[model samples]
Target: MENSAGCSVSLWQKIVSFLLVIFPILDIYSVGIKGIGIGSIILCFILIGMGIRFLTLNRSIKLNPYYGFFLYGLCISLLTVLIHNDFSITAVAIRMTYFLFYTLLIFLPSSYDFDIHFAEQIYLKIGMAAGAFLILQYFSFWGLRYNLIGLIPGLPLNYAIEDYVEWMDAYNNMYTIMFRPTSFFPEPAAFTQYMAPLLILVLFTNVGEKKKLLKAAFISIVMILSTSTNGIVFSLFIWILYFVYINHDSLKNRRFPIFLVPLFLFAIVFAILILFTDNTISDYTVQQFEGLFSKNQSSSAYLRIMRGFDIYRQLNFFENILGIGLGTYKSYYATGVLTVYDGETEYMNSLSYLFVSTGVIGVLLFIYSLFYNVPRRSMASHALAFLILLSFFSSSLFNSPTYALSYLFLLHLDSIKNSGD
Candidate 1:
């Protein structure tokens, strides 16, 4: 009976690990019946079961200091809601649910006794699977002129082709036809954001050099095929950092400039593509790169990077400090209660959303919580945290459980390393 029980527990652990591996995809709106994601529903049930199990076993719930930070932020959000007298039950409930999801994710690893190495392997494999699917997706479009995503049946009411397809005109005629592979995500950019930290782990952490390069190459291809400005720029930034800082020690030990070889090969391949191919994708990429710096009000670059700050500037002094309230930004923006820039349609940046909704104090507490446990000696930990922080400026993923889980996993890995050290 004891052996059987142990086997059952192990099986459940594997199930949880698998669920986490695909959690981002599972969290998509199309994967759920309503506004709630399938991932959330499953996790909520797991949380309840775990809660009951803990009670039956008389287990003490171990709390991290970050929990206090989250609690404080929740209090601040409630206060903001009260201050504004915008007590919409649905809105407050949604915000509360998000908080609960974050807390549950934070509790997960410890409760399940998740092995960091095992989790890394699972994440790597799943990432590879996503990459393989993306490649197949790309070819299907290239050859058949049909998006394989359309073949997947019975998506929820919220699912739409426009959510996954990148319109050609959006790139200002850089390409006649373009299909971005999302690989189970609502958009390609979300897929890239989900994969970014995994890329960092593969490149910077203590993985075998050959394995690292292979995995990095595959992941980089997926990011490129996605054609997301943020993904491409992030990939370039991390690769440069890897070559400069991470590879410096190895370069000093080796006589040959082996590291520079990859860059040279990449340049040659790029030149060949520009010279021989239609160069539509390359031209579109360059246009987007330029748009990143364009002063045009209608540019996606401006809206994603600077428009949030522009919106924040318009807020009153008190609103700037304490925020308007939790979950109020969407309604305010939709109703034109909040002043927006000429081309702004919605909040794309998470930092801006946090600033406008939770105010300065909430933002500080949240940031502090993520970094509080990071060991100063662990460069990998710092790099992981920095990448996550940078991603906030690109999208409104502040409430995403996948991002929360990534941070939690980082802390778990850091704790194990610190213990070994």
Candidate 2:
């Protein structure tokens, strides 16, 4: 009976682990409350159950020191809120709650003995499922002239056909027929952001070469089909970096071979530009590529990458050192001290959000915690860390439970691999 109970508990842990892995995608559903999300509620329950189990077993929980430092940073943020007297205390409290939740989640996998390999398998399965849906979504929309979301009943997706149409219109102003498949996400960029790190793991890690190449090819095709400029650019960047890293030993013995990757990419782009003339999708892609360097304040690229710096520049010295306050971005936005685009209150860039909301000290502590357990000598560890950091620049992911879980899972995978090596 004891053995059977142990097996059941183990099964329960595995189920929780799987749920945590997909929590980012699960965040879309609303549980009939404002400021309360399904993912957060599920996480709260998981943690509470774990807490009860620990207490029952009389197990002493020893958290990582970084979590202590993170708590300290939150305290500092609280102090900053007190000092500012202009930000919302309630907002800071709410933000602290989520931050605490995320910190505990970072420690959950190790405490529960969640297998890193199992997590990787979950990621791949998610990629495959999303890719399949994306393909069907694309064909169903373009060929059948039907929005795929409409066909699915009771899914409660956060987006509607009008939202997709608006996104499609953004990509091509003159021709609105071009459809980008978001799969389960609210937007194409979100889908790509979620998939980017998984792409890196499958391509760069020592996962079976045959399976890795096939998976990478399929994912790359999916990202391309999604038509997110961020996805396409990130995919190209990583592939080039991977090629260089893989051939570094051979290239060290020779010269000039390192330049071939860029040349190859350039050739492909040039061929596409020439062959796909008069094509709406190709023209829209080219337009977005050019928009990446646009100085216009309203361009998506500018809003995502440069707006954070603009906001950061407006901070007074004290605010710069300690930030305005946690979760105070909306309050700060309401102040109208700085010009914002599209009336969107949330900052697009995570790094910028971290800096603007948490201040310099908070940023340092967070970065240190993020890299604390990562193996310094392992190339895979560095690659995963780099990809995680890169993903932050595209959106407000610093406080996201999904990104936090992904970061923890990847680091756990690296530690496991390093120990094995």
Candidate 3:
């Protein structure tokens, strides 16, 4: 019986590890009838396993460095409810579960001695596979499109391709029309959010420098195919910052200059191909850049920033200071605000969403929570955090358990290195 139980636990770990590996690709499909995403499902499993271990073995789970942050978020959740005097038990329960599950996943690896390298290998492999799929997509080949709906009758995965985007000039005129390759996500930006940290991990791993550059180049192409300005922008930004900051030590060698020749040549060739064969990409990129200062912004930028002042004006003094309420932003408040803006969408970015839900205090506490728990080990870890910070400008990463935990995991991995030093 003892042996059997140990085997069962080991098998469970392996299963969880496998799920972690494919989590990014699995984002395309729901896990069950309830349509909970694979990310949440993975966390649910982790939470269950941890609970079992704790109850059965009487083992205590070690606290993570960010426990206070988690507690702070919890306090804000409940405090907002109390202040607003409007409480839904179901809403409170759901919100708490989200926080608890995230906290559990963030601390699981360290507590259970989870195989970090195994998970990273899985992420990198899936990333490469996703890149390959995007390449095929560019050639008009498809994967996991509308067909996934048939697999789950009541819950359709049709949302993955429900929306279409076209590249437009600065004047809002359509310049190039194509179905953006989502790869295995509902949108191309999701791929970027999933891949960016993994790309950083691959580069920083003890792999050959040549292999690293090759992997980077391949992922860069996929990001270009994603056609998401956020994807392209963050990829280039992190790649440059990583090399300049983290990889600088590797550059102080005799062969470093020799390595640059091929890199320069490759860039030249890639640019020439895009310029001649697909000038549409070049024109689209130029328009996006020019739109920054032009009278009319690109459609994407316009959607992101068009109503910034209008939204800011909607926040009253008390709401701005203490926040209206935790989940109230999405429920009662944000909906009304969106209706006021002629049906403009909320959560255009993380900052705005944070302001709406948590208000000024919540946002400040959240930022402090992130940095307060950050393991400031080496320059590489700092660079990793900086990359995550850059990503925050584009989307609400913390709200997603997977992205939040992944960011924490990377920081923890660097902290391990720091301890060894």
**Candidate that would win on TM-score:** 1
lDDT: which is higher, 1 or 3?
Answer: 1
Cα lDDT, all candidates = 0.65, 0.66, 0.56
Candidate 2 stretches greater than 4 Å from native: 1-9, 55-65, 84-86, 150-177, 249-278, 333-342, 415-421
Write model 2 residue lDDT over 380-402, tens digit each, in one string: 56666766677667667775755
Q: Provide the global lDDT of candidate 3 against the true structure.
A: 0.56
Q: Residue pairs in steric clash, candidate 3?
A: none
Question: Which tens-of-lDDT digit does each residue in 67-154 have in candidate 1?
Answer: 7766765676677567656456467668767876777776655535444555666788778887788777767766786556622344
Clashing pairs in 1: none
Candidate 3: segments with Cα more than 4 A from true spot = 1-12, 31-35, 54-65, 83-93, 111-113, 141-155, 158-176, 207-210, 246-248, 254-281, 288-298, 305-313, 331-342, 378-380, 415-421
Q: Residue 19 in model 3: shift from native, Å?
A: 1.6
In the range 1-421, model 3's lDDT, one tens digit per residue, is 1121122235555556656556545544555434356556666766677677767776766654467555655676677677656555467557667666666666654424345545555667788987787666555523332221102223334233322222112112322343455666656677777777766665555344457767876777677666676666666666676556544455565555634533463465348437533666656655654554464643554445444334655777886776544455555443354343435554546666566666777677766656655666544455566666666665656556446546555645652342112
| TM-score of predicted structure 3 | 0.76
State TM-scores per candidate: 0.83, 0.82, 0.76
